[model samples]
Each structure stands twice: as structure tokens, then as C-alpha cells.
Target: MGVWIRPEVFPIFGAVGAVVGICSMQLIRNITTNPEVRVTKQNRAAGVLENFDEGEKYAQHTLRKFVRGRRPEVFPNMNKYFAEKQ
Candidate 1:
């Protein structure tokens, strides 16, 4: 014996499927295209560093990353050390 859905219910199912498909497509597009939805640590750091000059910003970033808590005293001499490197 075969189970059967009503003829009217078939069209309703199609309509609901279409709606679900469209909504899923829209959700995928929003996820892929939305800039605010995806932000990485590196991207955020780059954004923050954009305000400074490239060379100096990298030097400062390196110093901050390696020497922040381990040796806070070295922070004050960063400019002096970078100056010697050049």
C-alpha cells in the first residue's frame, strides 16, 4: 500500500520548501558577504595598527608582544633599541 499526501498539501509543501530555500540562500549570502560578521585577531590588530607608520608600528608591535609583562622596564627603551637597529 502507498501512502499519499493530499493534492492541496503538495503545493503548500512546495511553497514552504521554496521559502526555506530562499531563506537559507539569504543566510549564506549574509554570512559570506557581511564584513562585520567575521573579524579575526590579526585583522583587528592590523586595523588598529593602520593609524601608525608601517616601520614604527611593527617595531612597536613586536616590542609590546614580547616585552609587555615579562620585562616592562624594557618598554621604555624600545625607541632606543629600534633606533640602534637602523
Candidate 2:
């Protein structure tokens, strides 16, 4: 069986969709592209450090795996510990 859309309503749907798409794109660009909505330099610096530590941890694991030619030890499943630690 085939579905049917009224030709008259199809254009209206397209017009509404275009308006919604434009508005959503504009909102996303305004939030992401504009600097005022972004994280401050201090916060970004902290984020950089956090990510660096995470990368270093992975690099260490890779070194252990290759240098010793052994499978890496699986890290224990830890509770989520970001921004929630005392």
C-alpha cells in the first residue's frame, strides 16, 4: 500500500520546515559561533589540563602494551568522578 500527501498541504509543510530550519540554524550558530556564549579562558585552561591528563593516561597504557608486548590491563570500572569529587 502507498501513502498519500495532499499536494496543497505539501508546500505549506515545506514552507514551515524551511522557517524552522533557518531559525534553528541561526540559534545554533549564534550560540556556538559567538564568543560570549563560550567558556571563559580560565575554564578552558582547566579543560585543557584535564584532557591532557586523560591523553597521557591512554599513552601510558599504549606504551605498556607495546613496550612489554603484553595486553594492557583493563582499568576497573570507576564511578563517574568529574566535577563531583570533594
Candidate 3:
């Protein structure tokens, strides 16, 4: 029984890896948002659960939306968090 990776499984493997990576990054982002998750023992923490859709709900109207911003837009404060504490 040599190592075996079925040809069809390659796409599935890539998809799963991408999903896991995105989720892990999101979780890390959520955790880093506020002091409560980092140090404070407060009951209520920062962060909101937002429900949104990509593009729009219909084709008749484009919904006049701007999807996909610059990479930096995803995590505006991530830079500060990673900055040295000097």
C-alpha cells in the first residue's frame, strides 16, 4: 500500500485547505479586535456579527456596488496590532 492521492481528490483538497485557512484567519482576526479577548476579563466584548451578500440580490439592477477592495481594507488595524510595542 504505497502513498495514494486519487486524481479527483486534488480539487477537493485544495478547496478544503482554502476554507480552513480563511476560517482560521477570521478567527484570529476576531480575537485580536479588542482588549477583552486579549487581556480584560469583561463580560461583553467588542465585535459585531454582520450579515452581507456579495454583489446583489437581483440582476435587473446592478445594485451599484463596489465589491472587492484593496487587500489592506480587510483588516485596517491589523498593521497596528502587529507593530512593535516600542
Candidate 4:
């Protein structure tokens, strides 16, 4: 009885492991490639706003767009935000 059940359980475990591995790889790839997940000095300096409050607003707006799946162009927007400041 035990031997019969062992074979069935092993395959199920293998299938679960494969699914988890694939999902983990995709998550890592997204984190590495997505700009919204990581901020850089260049992005911060690109904003034209001289004040912290204005900068915070711009960042929050960008992040909101990302969260909503709008995929707004972050770098160009940052550049434009700062360019407009001038």
C-alpha cells in the first residue's frame, strides 16, 4: 500500500516544484528589468522641480501609473518634468 502511494506523491511534488521554479525566474527577470522598481540619481536629477514636495508628487504619479499597468515612459517624463522647470 505504501509503495503504491509513494510513486503518486513524487510526481505531484515534481510538478509543483516546476511551477514554483518558473514563477520565481519570471519574478526575478521583472525586478531586474523594470525601471520603476529601481530608482537612480539620473532619474531624480531629471526632475525640474527644485523642491522636495514637487519631486515627491512627480514620483508618486509615475508609480501610480506603473501600478495601474499604464507603463508610462518614466525617464522621458522625468526629463520633461525637469525640462519644464527650466
Candidate 5:
């Protein structure tokens, strides 16, 4: 038995496949790059110890990623606007 897909619909199939692949890759990257996830995986593989500060440090997502990074502002000029108002 054989099935044939219309030529016009072939592009739609390719686009859907590309979108699915991109989404899956992004999901994997987010999980793998996460500090807490890494810490948990390490703890499991090496066996948990008394001092679990590694995971504790990354327990808070905002604290773990954003505190040391750039300011979480919507617009670049928003900070200036607030500062002048205050």
C-alpha cells in the first residue's frame, strides 16, 4: 500500500516539522542550561550529601538567573523616566 501527499500540502508539512523541531530544541536547552536542574542531576548521580547548598543556591529562579545579570526593565528609557519622576 502507498499513500501520496499533495504537492501544495508538502510545504505545510515541512513548516510544521520545523516548528516542532525548534520548540523541542528550545525546551531541551532551557532544561539543560538551568542551574537547579543541573544541581539535581548531579546530586542524583553522585548521591546526595549533607551540604546541599548547590541546589539551595539556585532554589529561587529569579535570584539564580537575574540578580547578577542586566536589569529587568521593559523599555530602555523606563529607568530614566522613573528616576526623573522620583
Candidate 6:
């Protein structure tokens, strides 16, 4: 008999390829449209790059920003370490 592949494998491959394609497209789009990457020497010399500020403020919104910036602690839940005894 000739070579035969199971039909079930086709959809799995298709789904994986679709996910990879979407992720790659998103990565490319982010790289191309990133404000920091597009900064020019002239803008830097002029002392005013609009894109720089936009880039800095890209994701400074809501709770995620605060959560990402929190200082790491060995025992985050041990508040008594810093608190004085009452």
C-alpha cells in the first residue's frame, strides 16, 4: 500500500501553523510600529522626539503598570518585618 497519514493530524498541523502565523505577524507589527525603534538622529539632536514620550507611555495604564513596577521582596507577605511592635 502507498504511504498513508492519519486524517486527524491535518487539523492539528493547521491549527499550529495558524497560531504561529498570527504570533509572527503580531511580532513584526510591533517591531515596525514601535516608536522607540523609529527615533532618528535628528530628533535626538533637536532635544524633542515626540515618539520618545509616546514610547515611554506606551503601557503606563491601569493596574498592570503598577503590578509590573513593584519592587521584588524575598518575603512579600511578611509585613511585620518592617512594622514596629505596638
Worst lDDT run of 10 residues, candidate 1, spans 47-56
State in Å the error of residue 77, model 3: 32
lDDT of 4: 0.68
Model 5, 1-86: lDDT tens digits are: 12576677879999999999999986785676544444465556865355556455546556556666667677859888888998
- CA displacement after TM-score superposition, residue 81 of candidate 2 (Å): 70
Off by over 4 Å in 1: 1-4, 39-86
Clashes of each: 0, 0, 0, 1, 0, 0
Local accuracy by lDDT, each model: 0.63, 0.60, 0.55, 0.68, 0.67, 0.67
Q: How far in Å is the alpha carbon of 50 misplaced in model 6?
A: 5.0
Q: Runs in model 6 with CA error above 4 Å?
A: 1-4, 38-86
lDDT of 6 at 22: 95
**TM-score list, all predictions:** 0.42, 0.38, 0.40, 0.38, 0.39, 0.41
Worst 10 residues of 5 by lDDT: 34-43
Per-residue C-alpha lDDT of model 1 across residues 1-86, encoded as one tens digit per residue: 13576666878999999999999986885566444444566665654333336445434555477766674454658867887999
Give the TM-score comparing model 4 with the true structure, all chains together.
Answer: 0.38
Candidate 6, residue 58: how far the Cα is off, in Å: 7.1
* Candidates by lDDT, descending order: 4, 5, 6, 1, 2, 3
Per lDDT, the best of the predicted structures is 4
- lDDT agreement of model 6 with the native: 0.67
Between prediction 1 and prediction 4, the one with superior lDDT is 4
> Model 4: per-residue lDDT, tens digit, 4-49?
6777688899999999999997688556554444457676567653
- How far out, in Å, is residue 30 in model 2? 1.0
Best by TM-score: 1
lDDT of 2 by residue, 12-69 (tens): 9999999999999878855654434445667555542435564555446644667576
